[model samples]
Target: MDTDLTPLRDRIDAIDRQLLELLNQRARHAQDIGQHKHRAGQPVFRPEREREVIAKVLQANAGPLLSDGVTAIWREIMSACRALEARQQVAFLGPEGTYSEQAARQFFGSSCSFAACTDLDEVFRSQLSGSSAFAVVAIENSTEGAVARTLDLLLAHPVQICGEISLAIHHNLLRRHDGLDGVAAVLAHPQALAQCRQWLDKHLPGVERRAVSSNAEGARLAAHDASLAAIAGEQAASQYALQVAAPRIQDEAQNRTRFIVLGGQPTQPSGHDRTSLILAVPNRAGAVFGMLKPLAAHGVSMSRFESRPARSGAWEYFFYVDIEGHQDDARVARALDALRQSCAFFKNLGSYPIGRE
Candidate 1:
């Protein structure tokens, strides 16, 4: 029986045409805004504005499509519109197929090209050298407190945090064949290996585990060696042509990694925002209290706090603080001004939108 589709076909075709026209119209307006922004000396990408737009669309959503589905379609639309003005070049820690790359794409969309670096330092360097417009680096993992190297780099570099992304870490045990028998060693990034430690101990007990540069690299190596397995993600499995020997092998079911987009400029507050800082308290008595007192006084709340070795003098350390407001907020500004005096050293890492995928 032939379904009566004439009316539906006509409606779909008409809607498709209208959609194309609307997209182009939106692109034209975006280009005009880009020109205006250029004349006013504004950054091409505004994370806060993007977040606001996404939130608005999600709030307006009331149909068959979920929030993520709406976001996926709108991201490409915005990506293309942004490209009509300028396309971004992003750098990430990778040999390709790294979670860093995934985070970069999740934030930047498909309009941009990526510069894959061998190490995190290279990712930063790419941004500094103009090889990339932005750099995405993993700052912290839910399962592993924080990435110490990223924290140190944040202090050492002059780059600002323009945006951030949180990616759920689903570690997959990949293999050349379906069977795990005769597997000699498991290869993965050190962090990936650690995240899957308990699972490996229980399932692949007594097998030698080796650390590699990246999980994707481990997958690549595993693809070439039949006797080896790798702990990586789906991207790695596809990129290296490996099978999913086991899925979700991480110790924690709710593993997530937070990545920051570093650029030369900072983000403007979009109502909802976050600011990061690196500071050290004075050597005097009650110095820590002095450092934190202003935040309470100004009603500025803290979201995270971690300390790292100062690396210069013994017992001297730098505290990485994540506050729940933009640096420009009146109270936050007051808190920072008051707290500045309590520190032997201080650096404002950056402020960025709090909401992200």
Candidate 2:
């Protein structure tokens, strides 16, 4: 004899219907808020506000669902609501299927519009030209370190960081044919090629490595050329209709890349935030040490510090620093004030809510 399960199924269906009704109510309220924002000339998409919402929900959560799952569900709901007000136009490096694209979708959600650019420079240009409201570009990689072009563009462009994403990258060797036979060369972005250097050397010895604008672009090229195998992500393999000759070809198993979300205005203080800056100290003895003393004195914590060449004839370096607090915080403000006196050049790259791993 079999036990009857119709009652449980009926209960689940009733709960699902209730959930749908509640969701619709939330969406209606969101639409009403959007109308008010439009009348007040306020931005529809506010990262800080979204962060606060997520925090509140997480604080109230006591369930079998994990924090990540809850955050993702709420984000999609918020994204859809914001789109009803005004769909955000976002830019990223691509022809589509790049990790940069993935980061953009992750941050903005799939409700926003995407403008794919051929290069990082174009990604900035699209936003500056008003073609896109936001731009996402990879700034650093765990294995390969900083992306120099993105760093340079950040300095040159008027855009600032409003948010960030940390994406775990998994590279795959994709080709048109079934197997890796007749594969003459490996194509991918320079960073991708470097990330998978050990794997390529051991497997496809003596294959010429060609760097392209992006891993997706390499995959696109490989789709048409049987002699070339591209190193890209699973998304590229699916997008280009290529077969994954070999998966997870990167040297490191847990390779990750950090991408920054760029926008025109500075984000409001989110209690938990990170402030990025670019500084050049006076060319003198103890100048660098003096520049850092304020943080120690004020009891502010620093998360990252890197030096990029100033590219001037004289040897000067620009120090990029990421500190733990918003610029408005008393301690951070005091430290920045004292820090400014020792610098020849200083640029605050905006404070944003720190991205979760």
Candidate 3:
């Protein structure tokens, strides 16, 4: 026989009612703040402020709930309150169920609107054209070093990095049918195909692999054709009404993707921040070292350094660097000034809060 849970259920119900009352109270306070902001001509959403709020809430968290759960709860609460002021419109590459879409939701929460674009170019265009407030685009992955198209777009577009999201990736084999039997062609993005290469080689040796624009697109195709299967996340499976043939089939167990939030305005320093920049140093023998000397002198820490071909028919390259502090910081500003003097081409890609994994 099971012990009675009526009293426990009643207690939880009462607590939930209290939570509802408190949330509404918070929302009303947010609306009052929004009124003041409107009078001051200030923007409704502030990324730096949101970061501080999350950090403070996490610091005060007492236990019971896991850190992730607490973060999610506070994020939703803030999101709801923010919606009372203004709901953000975010853009991402997808029909639906793409990792980029998930990353956008992770950053902005479900209270915001989403504009799904066919390609990365469209994703960037949506925000640049004022159709969306921000664009969440994949920058790099653990298995795949960088998304080359996104990096190139970053160089091409007049956009600024406002925030970031680091999402754990788990690829599942999705199909209309339950088993892998009769699955003719496997569909997925090229990177997803590469990440699960070893698994595919062992499980479905002779199956044809077809590359698509995104995993969600592959999932959409797999939904209609029982002969085709998709390598994507569980979200794709649910979105397309497909069954999971195999779950977490990626070669690496700890695969993750880093997505950057692109916006028109630069973000204010959030104390804990990361500044990104694109540079092309003069083609002198010690030019690269000369450019880096200021960062060392100013005591600025560099987290990432990546080089991409400049495509000018010459052998020149563009270097992308991520530093520890915001560009507004005194040390970082000084380093950036010296860097500008040392480079042939320099582009400050805006500073934003460091994404938590």
Candidate 4:
């Protein structure tokens, strides 16, 4: 006999039975917790708690399965348990197969409901209108840079950033045809098209590139037209039943996008956390330097700093900054107070756990 997989599979089946029993037990306990939370008027979805559980599961994974594979299995199990508690409806910038929808599903899971929004404004509006409890939208992408519309929406909306998620982007060129002989135009969001600019230039130099509202929308359009190809994530390719003409087409191999979860309430400190702020510096000399000195002196490490034109007047601008400590931390509190006195203005964007891998 070459080998006997029967005995190994039987043992695995026994272990899987035990796991199923434990998972059901966990679900019951989760439902009980949900009941208590509802009675106490607390939010059912706790991102920090979920992060802790994911970290624990990923650490305990030993062999055979990769970290991401294990995480996906655990996420689905957790998603089922959460569904027992209650269904949560989330909205994202979408036309069904967009990256924002993928990010939302990655953060929330398959069991939860999702609503598609045409734009970032619609994402916020859906939540405001009581149509969605939470919203997910991209903040920045490593290859193409910050999404200006998302930044502008954050300024206009009063929502707080409750959680953050980073998604690795692998753009695929999808089409329904057997070959690219007759393909005339490549359609995708401007960002997606730009991310794969080199690849498109090399392969389809003379083909016209058209911008669409979203990559998913492009995929949808491509579904009906044989002459078009969509550059979108794998999920879109699979969802639309399109053949992948090309995959991993982004110019940057390490392409990733940082997305944020927006909700009405702020989050409590989760120990390992980050805080975001939007402030304005005076026009005088060393304005930016003076405004950030307090954070440096207080030992609060800055993670991100960006600027956007302010609505007040010409040449007026606001600075967006992310620092390493929760707002309630003593040093962080002191830094915020000191900055208020030195800066022209400041808006606290809320503190949240630095979302884990």
RMSD of every candidate to native, in Å, equals 1.5, 1.9, 1.5, 2.0
Model 4 over residues 191-217: C-alpha lDDT tens digits? 999999999999889999999988999
Which pairs of residues collide in candidate 3?
Answer: none
lDDT of 2 by residue, 24-119 (tens): 899999999999988998888889889999999999999889998998889888898889888889999999999999999988888999999999
lDDT of 1 at 18: 100
For candidate 3, write residues 294-315 as lDDT tens digits.
Answer: 9999999999999999998888
Worst 10 residues of 3 by lDDT: 1-10
Ranking by TM-score: 3, 1, 2, 4
Question: What are the lDDT figures for the candidates, one per model?
Answer: 0.89, 0.91, 0.92, 0.87
Candidate 1 lDDT, tens digit per residue, 53-127?
888999999989988889979888888898888877999988788899888888888898888899888888899
Off by over 4 Å in 4: 1-7, 311-313
Candidate 3, residue 181: lDDT: 95
Q: Model 2, poorest ten-residue lDDT window?
A: 1-10
